[model samples]
Target: MSAGNIRLYSYWRSSAAYRVRIALNLKGLPFETMPVHLLQDGGQQHTPEFNDLNPQELVPVLMHGNRILRQSMSIIEYLDETWPTPPLMPATARERQRVRAIAQMIACDIHPLNNLRVLQFMDKTWNVPQAERDTWTRHWIKVGLDAVEDTLCDNPSTGDFCDGEQPTLADCCLVPQVFNAERFGVDMAPYRTIRRIVQNCLAMDEFKAARPENQPDAPAPGGN
Candidate 1:
């Protein structure tokens, strides 16, 4: 297969988009970024063009040649399968499941509750106050991170990264969730293991480059 043309539809502050960015950076694949301002003009994601691209009207849509891939985890897995030099899934079947489980613990269980659209709906439709909305965000993040901490703490497979010493699907899912936690002022002290993993991943160039504030469209690091 040819090394295909790649394009990424992304929003600067989107954790899901950030996850795909990290995966792309780690794979050392160059791709064009097409910004879809999730909050501008009543969310450009809801526009007819973007909606046609993804009926869900979500960010981080990966266009691999003719294939349009949605869902951050699925996109990353596609990248891993298509270009398998540094594998994201472990060689062992059970260990790969462990990594995927840890990843899904955040992607499926946690992120859906606190996503941009969900929070926006809470604020606009339900009239939730800013403080209450923050509470709502932090509450889910804490719950998810707590479970992640337990998983990492108990699982012997965990190393400096989520699985073994090298970063994997687990770490790709994790760094973005931690970013969301810090954004909402979720106390990191309670999840020491999770914080340690976040710190280790942040030290890497790939994670740093993929951070929300690192994007061209993002506000300065401390601005938000």
Candidate 2:
């Protein structure tokens, strides 16, 4: 682990890991990726070896030499601090707070109800049918995105990104959530602001390269 060397434990389709990939690419930091197959062999995240890295049994665990970081939001903040040339937070504290709030709307409120384990629990415990599980995921994502669309569309502060003219931590959180929403068949026609912002993000090489489908460990065509 030399200087600037980072190892990220990631799953190709993980929205959290996708966020970190954008942060790393935006900061112009290069890192090695270790694919953690979430569905293979009964979930590698639950294994003892991986558990040593993150007791929470989650992906997007970052290793920088002796130091280990967890949580996509925390890791992105650390990256922004360590590599500040391309600042992720806005200059003013108030703007930064707004940016963080938008980011958390997706990360905390929308995502928790739709994560793999939650869906799995619904299936394994309550015997929820696949169609109903999809409905559950779509409901949360739509509700969350509706609020986010309102905030961004109604606010004067929003620029090409979530806050100001520059890309911030909020954009990093946003694109991935949008991707997940589309995958689950949530209609995007109503979210004009989000669609515009995501279009701007996808135009940049940093964001394009961070897409889940572009990851090395992503499933091949036809879902492998």
Candidate 3:
């Protein structure tokens, strides 16, 4: 498969979109990124055109050939299956399960509580103060990453990256969550294993290119 006509609807700072970007880059796939600003004009994703593309109105929607793919993890798996070189998954089924577990710990358990939509709802629906929301975000992030740190440290399978010295689906998910955590001032000192893995990941051009700041839609430095 040539991975022909690939396009991604993304937001620069969206962790979900960031994961997909990493997967695409790791697979050496060239893609067109269609920016969907989640905060501008009450969210470009809510627009009629975008709604037709994905009723969930979430970013990280991937269009490959004529197929429409939603959800960051699914998109990454699709890419991995479609393009197997530089495989992002381990060889055995059990190892793949471990990778998915780590990925979901962040994507499913941690991210939902602090995603922009949830924070916005807290502010608009209940009038949660910004400082309080920041606290809430930091709390959940700490709780989640604390478990992730233990998971990585305890598992002998863990190597330079999330699994076996190469960036896996787990690393794709982990780095973005760590980015959000750092942006909100969550302490990273406690997650030594995760910090080490993320450092290893960022050293790679694929991961560097997928950073939020490297995205075209990212706000100008010191301008946002």
- Model number with the top lDDT: 3
lDDT of each: 0.89, 0.93, 0.94
Clashes of each: 0, 0, 0
- Candidate 2 wrongly placed segments (more than 4 Å): 1-3
Off by over 4 Å in 3: none
Q: How would you encode candidate 3's per-residue C-alpha lDDT over 1-224 as one tens digit per residue?
A: 98779999999899999999999999999999999999889889999999999999999899998899999998999899999988999999999999999999999999999998899999999999999999999999999999999999968999999899789999999999999999999989989999999999999999999999999998999855
Cα lDDT of model 2 by residue, 1-224, tens digit: 13377989999889999999999999888999999999899999999999999999999999987789999999999988888878999998899899999999999999889999899899999999999999999999999999999999978899989997889999999999999999999999999999999999999999999998898998888884
Per-residue CA lDDT of model 1 for 48-91, tens digit only, reads 99998999999889998889899999999998999896787889
RMSD of candidate 2 to true structure, Å:
1.3
Question: Any idea what lDDT model 1 has?
Answer: 0.89
* Per-candidate RMSD, Å: 1.4, 1.3, 0.7
How do the predictions measure up, each by TM-score?
0.96, 0.98, 0.98
Worst 10 residues of 2 by lDDT: 1-10
Q: How are the candidates ranked when ordered by lDDT, highest leading?
A: 3, 2, 1
Clashing pairs in 1: none
User: Residue 165 error for model 2, in Å?
Assistant: 1.3
- Given candidate 1, what's the lDDT at residue 141? 89
